[model samples]
Target chain A: MSFPYSEKVMEYFSHPKNVGEIEDADAVATEGSPACGDMVKLYLKINPETKSIEDIKFKSYGCASNIATASIITELSKNKTIEEAKKLTWKKASETLGGLPPAKVHCAVLAVDALRTAIENYEHKMGLLKEKKSTDTNIIEKRLKRVINPLTGLEVLKVNFVKKIDLDDGIITITVNLDSDHPFANNIREEIVERLEPLWDIKKVYVIFNDENERH
Target chain B: MEKRNVYLDNNATTRTDERVVEHMNHYHLNDYAVASSQFSHTPGIKAKDGIEKARQIIAEKISALNNEIVFTSGSAESNNLALKGIALANRAAKRNRIVVSKIEHFSVLDSAKRLGKEGYDIAFVDVDGEGFIDIDHLKNLVNDETLLVSIIHGNHEIGTVQDLHSISEIVHKKGAYFHTDATYSFLQIPVDVKKYGIDLMTVSSDKIHGPKGVGALYVSEDVIIEKITDGGFQEFNLRGGTENVSGIAGFGKACEIFSEEDVERIKYLRNDLYEQFKSGLKGVQLNGSSDFSRRIPNNLNLSFDYIEGESVVLHLDMRGISVITGSACFSRALQASHILLAMGFSHERAHGSIRFSPSKYTLKEDIDYTVHHVKEVVTKLRKLSPLVEQQ
Candidate 1:
């Protein structure tokens, strides 16, 4: 009867809030190490003019402590201004959840990292714009990085976020960086292709990962 | 809170059987005495008799001579005695190597590691995915310089039983003594010291519903073991401590509870439940052997993909069913099951492993309830899992 979790942590785990992806989020970030077997993808729809978190959601693949921390983070950060959300610490998030077990504090740390990352992405995107002008090819890399390949746990830069970054007159060709014997090599390629294919008016978005000839 | 309790964690420990309890209570109430003071008083004489009778019962169970059994604290201590005691006792010019299998319990592994630092060369033989030792590889490792080869009789995580008959033979052929930690597999399967030709073995009392503090190490006549602890002239001067009179009495009583028919009944129920879980759930893979004859009767280790094993354990606990996981997060070091990893399981699959062990007292309805709960828990957890649908 003495579970290590608080009632609040268990509640959030059993019935997580704001789950799943936001198909076209203004900012997105993934946190946690796949090697540790805990990962979180935080997708946020921001109020552009107000610079506030509007709608928030999460997709977490981890233990109960991890999922609960992710769910609680979304609940505590939604509708907050960027400054306020970034100020939130892992300690505060754990206290808000009534407290996690001593061994599970890393889960809270991951939640805060994801939130801070999302806001930073928003700020970076906002910096490039007067407002809402994301038709740039470089913006494509940021968006594709949002798709956290479960295995590598790396985003755009580590896993072929644009291996060469070539931009022709209209064609924007990008290659995915994948491991040779990766089990989800196909899904990673498809996700990158699916995300970039709908951006701007690019004539073509070619998908490639772990290209053998290029892998010297 | 009002729901019925379901305890299927017999491999970890079990409720002390009522018969064992009665013997323990009797000895605790009346027979408590200094067994070494047998020349002094009546209580001392009675205590000495109780210790001897208990020793005789354990000796008969394993078909070993009464003098060959040295009672220690538990299987962990017995392993220490068998490995280190033998090593220190036989610390000679030539014999200075140790070999243990990868799938041995932590006690055997840790003890062998301790010997390694003291100048003994240590090597581990690999196991197949099902946890069977690679026999040819083992044969190649053991040489005349090899001091002792210790392996588990049955893996506590995967329930894969190592064939002591062949393993002991290999060690003996190389002139190295063999020790098997039979803590988990002792009474659950058929064990005979002579039939397997084991030079040494460790058996636990608590594992068979006896008292926890009493365990015995079966050291053959030829193996000279040095004292791990010293003081008194007890346990043939090898283990120097006063006997745990009540626990030893209970240990002997627990030894008489097992029969071939009882083991068959346990196997039938374990196999039946394994079938139910496999048939009822998707991606529900049994970790060890499916063939009933190859593994222990009351043990089943299974893994469900796309989720962590700790969550399943918590979910089952919430429903009043007790279980354990082999995942590293659940382990002492927060490391995943070395057994599963050594058997070639991916880290993800290793974290997803669960061990279900039921004693002879487990009812059919208890098994059914556990299975139904496991299916429900796995489905619910999958819905919360991020990796299940992504890949």
Candidate 2:
């Protein structure tokens, strides 16, 4: 287990700082699907003057990987401009944490996704983007309807598979309730992304399978 | 600091006793002949003597006749044989039905499920909150059409021991056969199939510190139970295979060595550990019967809410303490303890359940260390849990 992750990942996990919520933060974003059992919520206080992230913190509901990555991402984003923070990829998050297991690499992906979501929310709230309602939720819903889940063989909609769908600042986050019994979740995610690919206003698309792992 | 091994999963499998190993080795090296061999060679007679001796001891321990004990691979196969073999034999009787408790082990449950394909109407009896069998429900389920009523003597995960005498009476009133799986309770508790009115019973050697790959099914005299395998006329033409003479010898040695006093001492240790665990821990709820006499003396199952049981088990494992969890994440069970769920526990409680079964070899120090490490693990995981933060 020690070699599965670097000392840095374990360190952040054991002594995770900025581990609470920002009560009245300017921007907030919760990411990760409940189906896979890992979730992270990012809270931010963006200084309007410099358009930089003045304060950042997180609340994570996952294993050591999720907690450490969320803690590291928050620390890495603090004091950085909104645009600069938005540029940080999941790879950079893992690189900063020394390294992460390939399977657990999603923990870092979730961290950066949460950060970008917060940034997107911040820009929309600041009136940088006008009212942000171009995302017709039904288009994604209709696209999801036609998809017959590869494993269950039933239509995804028939099983009540859609867990969550959040639209904020033209950024769409679709959380599908994919149990371990469900197959080809990647294909479902890909189909959803492809269906939304034509929409220019939707800057970012997140199709997450169940994020929660151990306990719901 | 690294911790030494503290194995508390004795119900899963006990460490083979040294005497059992020695007895097995004796048969393997010196008396390595087919037990059923008719040739009058000394080695062949020795093998045959070993098998017969082991069978007599096992039968005596359970208060059965020597010829009644039919040897099989282990309890699972014995369970299948007792259920499917009996069902197959009695299908001509036109009863075409079976009754089993919801808390019966998967071996019995799965066997009954397989029997369902053969047109046997399988009825699951309910259990109370403490995992006790509901007698009224059992009375309602048993009728003229019921061919066999199989109930486990003790629950494995929750450690709930059912009263076989009472259950046997109810099944007998309806003229149906009563089968009890005594795999967990036979050696740890005083299980007398005749005294309890049990028509058939399943017992495992490995669960009682004996060699693996050996078990027995006590078929009451004149039950006329059918055999699944068709081979040489061994095991009185019931279990048709060459006997595992070495393993059976080892099993007999284990049974003889495990005395009545051993039961009392193990029960004392179990209660002592339970007292400390209940007093030492917070938000820890015991899963099975509160009465120690009504549960397996070697088992203590507990649940801690908010945090997953798998987390606690894994953390303890990292500290060199082996245990099992009812958590869906750790088990073949897609979610929570089915035993707990049957007893009407919330999904969270089932997800947070852990079963710790200590043997006679489990030292008081090992129990103390286990409790200390368990508290530490639960506290840490609760802190890390998002569900806790949400609360």
Candidate 3:
């Protein structure tokens, strides 16, 4: 049977680059969860003087697309300034690998998330990050944009599943336009909670379904 | 020489036997008339004879009467027919409940779900860790109001073989018709429908090295089942369609060509492959029954720790070995195998599960090659896995 992978994806997956831990790393961050069947941990050793990434490595516990995406993202960010690496997008990483399957585009997102989080960690350590305000709707929406609908391979917000977002007394309630019985409903909800729960000021995160489409 | 391709996914589908193919060529080329035309022309008579001969062979294999076998497209249709047909026929008989195991093929499970949507009380019986149906739970669920209790004889993924005799006994005691999807166990294990007290059995030819698109459902003569498909009278009026004469002939030829010796040899290879993995790898767990006799002879499912199964599957594919994984990443639904999850495995365990099913055509060299490449792939992936601790 034919595999649903591009030749570049297979090439990187079969022989992935930067597949290890950076033992005395400047910054490290992990994204995704084992329960979701995809996780990537990125390690960066940045040059403090020039603010450039001296070396970058990654370890993945996921499928070929996850490994391939992580490999491509590390290749794209090595030796670049931390600011430049932070500017790298998941779409660019996936495009460099000749584009992933629609179902696997989320792996690219996870890779980019891990890389940016590691850069953020480095910035926080160097006191380069600004004093952040308390969590707000815009920050919640920015994080929610990372939550992908598995069926559509796009952000839940972009797919118009986020019907409403309400933040009150540190409690975030997001209403999605899907029934609980939809095949990917639980996945979307779990991802939303996973994304919003880690905010510094968030107290509780609740995801409610609109039950508007229960065809599944 | 080019690297040899080793296929260990026989549980998915087998390579059709050459002898069966040669036998089918005659019906496809010469006697290409529909069996319904038996009263019309000479070729039609030959086609009818060919189909009847196939029916007789399949019936004899399961120790059923020739008239009891109804041909369907394959096991999925057979399962759909058995569940929906019995539910429809017994709609007015005061039995509105259907009980099935949680680990049944989607054909059985989804059909029962459809029946539930139509107002039938559907109950899913649980399975133990080894994928065996819980006997006491089944007994509790299947009562007088239950029209059918459908379970799989041999689980397709994990390879656990259920005790049909005791299951049938329980269902019969409750006055419920017992149906089994024996697609994986039809030829691999001996099944006597009469001895097991099975009312309906679904068997597919493709799993037994026969041509695809042909399967038979054995319905006991006393069971009442309505036709789900409406068409011209065919398959004893229980199923309506033009017969697949060539595929049926090929299926019969496959059954005739099946030898017990091949099963014994494939079992040996399967066991040897597992033994090699146990000796060569660390943190490898067997997912199915520990008892060899209770599992499908040609099936072995293993979960390698730390590393995900899809990576191993792709790496093995690069080395020309074919296998399947239960990882959510590998499925379009983005969910792990329901069978493994229903067995109470963690998502990590389910993501690491791999199924290797060797057929009679698999060789010792193939097993050795697979084990070696699998070890290399697992070791490499484990090093790159965030779940694995750095030493």
Best by TM-score: 1
Clashing pairs in 2: A33-A211, A35-A210, A36-A210, A36-A211, A36-A212, A37-A211, A37-A212, A37-A213, A38-A211, A38-A212
Lowest lDDT 10-residue stretch of candidate 3 chain A: A146-155
True contacts kept of each: 0.25, 0.12, 0.71
lDDT of 2 at B136: 97
* lDDT tens readout by residue for model 3, A1-216: 566999999999988998898889988777776657788888899999999998999999899999999999999999999889989999999889988899999999999988887787676557686785677888888877655554333556787868888899978888887777754466556557756765656667888887642212
Q: By lDDT, rank the candidates, best first.
A: 3, 1, 2
Per-residue CA lDDT of candidate 1, range B343-363, in tens?
887666777888898887888
**CA-lDDT, candidates in order:** 0.80, 0.80, 0.88
Query: Between candidates 2 and 3, which one is better according to TM-score?
Result: 3
Provide DockQ values for all models, in the order shown: 0.32, 0.12, 0.33
Q: Candidate 1: where is the Cα deviation over 4 Å? A: A1-3, A33-35, A121-216
Candidates ranked, most accurate by DockQ first = 3, 1, 2
Instruction: Give one digit per residue, the lDDT tens place, for model 2 in B176-195.
Output: 99999989887777878888
Could you give the C-alpha RMSD of every candidate to the true structure, in order shown? 4.4, 8.4, 7.9
Candidate 1 chain B worst ten-residue window by lDDT: B382-391
Model 3 over residues B1-391: C-alpha lDDT tens digits? 2477999999999999999998999998998888855467888899989999999999999999999999999999999999999988988889889999999999999999999999999999998999988888988898889889999999999999999999999999989999999999888899999998999999999999999999989999999899998996898899888899999989999999999999999999999999999999999999978898999998999999887888888888888999999988888798899999889887778889999999989999999889888998999998988767668
TM-score of each: 0.88, 0.77, 0.87
lDDT of 2 by residue, A1-216 (tens): 344668888788767878777788888776653233455778899998999899998876555677789999988889999989989988888998888877678789988977886787677567666455555777567645644443333466678676777778867787777744333355456446644543546666777777543211
Write the number of the candidate with greater TM-score, choosing between 1 and 3.
1
